[model samples]
Target: MQPLPRHWATVRETVAFPNTQEYALTIHGASDLSLEDAQRDAQERMALLIASGGPGQLHDSGLEYYPLRRLPEELLEELRSPGGELIAAISRNRYGSAVLNTDALLISDVDLVEPSPQDRAKPAGGLLSRLFGGGRQAELTPEQQDPDAFGLPGLHRRGEHHERTLHLIEDFRARHPELGVRSYRTRNGFRLLVTGTGAGPSSKRARELMGQLRSDELYMILCRVHDSYRARLTPKPWRIEVDRFEDLGTRTSADETHHAWVARYRAASEDVAVCRLLDVSGPAPSAVEQQIIDLHDRAVRPESGLRLA
Candidate 1:
């Protein structure tokens, strides 16, 4: 599994082309980049982009198995084990939600609905497809091909979706009796934390288990790219009736306006929960798993009686 970098830096520069068009570029580094190192890297990438005559900006492509190496999020907190090993990092996401990033634990986010045909039509490129290529569409089983195969009564009914999702979890538990599974009910689907089955998010075993559980494809790809699993720990801004933060990128500093927005967001989200504890099945979580579970429960307030957002 890839470890989270302790240092982060961003370099910005303006490049003037032969056409007299100047473009502003921003590059990020996470491997304890010094000022000189960042500038050199930025210049090298800028030259490549110029030679290729591509877009002036660097596109994340929503791909990369080691995105955290250049992750552009504001780090909020770090969760370390008693042995002083970093277990997780909480950061403010681009959408203003607090996200938990971890490499040690295997976390899966499974969506209830299947992707539309349009979504499947797009070519699977980037780091994810490069590493875990082929069978993009061929991997779908018969059950996965049918939208109503989950015993969902209606396509738009939330209650039916929730029930079907729970049934899926129960069936999975019955099939794999040796693995420990902690399931949570999310707004769109389910979040699962599994133990006694896999060790790290980057392992083949983790991918196989996620595939067996029908986890979200993009999420699975992200896990592979980041070499870690991520879960949202806070309610979405839209769900709480708050506008998204204006600046949504690698932040050098937080301003008064950002602080005020966070205050309002927290106040509005005070009564909402990100997920609710659905069930725990199969086996007991190990000591390490328990620590992660405790941290997740505390942040998400699974027993708060609040509606999931």
Candidate 2:
């Protein structure tokens, strides 16, 4: 996924949280922005996004904006611990940079690496700042308690939470076109980082809903994502569905129908080479069965027999 481009500081340093109970969001632009500015900006936007129904009460947003392939395995291991939320992906300034816990994580300079990970441990609820009193969340040491948390930038680890991560990324792009949009699923739930500005609801209405967002309402905004892109991507009736699939079997006419070779980049969890039909129809009775047989034969792997291609 093309990450939300960093503009905060030209240079960023990602510290391995090292089993810390909490973590920082991102440091992509940290060099340009002061720790205070980064800290304040991330916190305030996160609060608004939460009020608008973004992920609420997260400790750190994790390394939300940068690309992750650049990081190491040990650092990736740490992100597996539940600690951050999608708030880290939100761009606070036109710079398209964000770091929710700059206070907690970026208090001083440290090492850096690529952002992104694949572990999900469910972010705990409530504001660390609120608990610590007046945004002093950074003062709390890792030894305090809580699971040592870590996370992937931009990428969702898995589960319904992925919906939140993707939604935030889309939200930032939709909210601020100047930042440019990143890859994301379509409005109908299909994974497609559609082009153009988002769809429906003036920015005002969209902002209103976002302000009132809560865990329950997270889906509400995510749903809007599809609407935002539905028009931009290729138009198709089926794409509206998130993971819909059909058995691509049964007899059908060859007319109007089309055939094409297909393969899934996904793992073999699904029947590898299974003939999943896209659509079916026939002009005449004989055509239906022949069309199905031909497609089915081509789709499924052939038995131990060879024939002319």
Candidate 3:
């Protein structure tokens, strides 16, 4: 899983070029770093940036070239198991809603809208691009090209996408009787939480299962990159008619403004639910899984009867 650094800090530096022009650069670090340590790290990185002719010269560089092992969100809380293992974490995403992050207990969502052929063929480009060169186009394997060939039912009719997606979920439940699946209805599609199968987000089994269930391709890529699964626990700001919170960058703590914003968001979101509980199938969740489910249910208010956001 991506390391959720307990500490964060930011450093700023001014670099002077040979042409007598100066540029200011800010860097954020999450390595439990002291101000001095962060400053030193920033200085080293800035020196390299200067050697490469500053930030202006690196317009073509892709994000894959950068080392990004830590999640770039503010950690709100951490959940642990009886044995002291970190089971889950709650973090404030950039859009101001809380997100649930877990290294275990697979969580995936299936969008209602199908991707176009071109979109489906696009490479995810993290470890996949590193293993197979970025220029290579992704080709659908036989199973992806023909899901029906693997005993999975295909959606044949128009406007039945929702029902067809549910059918796929039921098919998955029928095939994998050993795993427990909890389904919820989100505003855009369905959210699935699986248990009784101990597969980490980046595991091969997880990849295959998510693919078979038709989880969002970008979501799968993000899970693989971050080594974790994520689910939003709160309504989107716009959905609740609240403005987005300011981008806090790498600040270690929240201020009065952030607190006030959160207060308003919470108040507006009080009558809204993120998702509604649809059904549970397969088997009962284990003790640890139940703990996660409880936490998730509390945050989402699955039975609130309010409109999903």
Off by over 4 Å in 1: 1-27, 33-71, 113-158, 246-250
lDDT of 1: 0.68
Itemize residue pairs with steric clashes in candidate 3. Answer: none
Judged by TM-score relative to the true structure, which candidate is superior, 2 or 3?
Answer: 3
Would you list the rank order by lDDT, best first?
A: 3, 1, 2
Residue-pair clashes per candidate, as listed?
4, 23, 0
| Alpha-carbon lDDT, every model | 0.68, 0.25, 0.72
Residue-wise C-alpha lDDT for candidate 1, range 115-190, written one tens digit per residue: 4466446566632243234436234343333332333344323333444566677888888899888888676678
User: After TM-score superposition, what is the CA distance of residue 284 in candidate 3 from its true location, in Å?
Assistant: 1.8
Model 2 residue 307 lDDT? 16
Cα distance off (Å), candidate 2, residue 274: 16
Q: Quote model 3's TM-score.
A: 0.71
Ordered by TM-score, highest first, the candidates read: 1, 3, 2
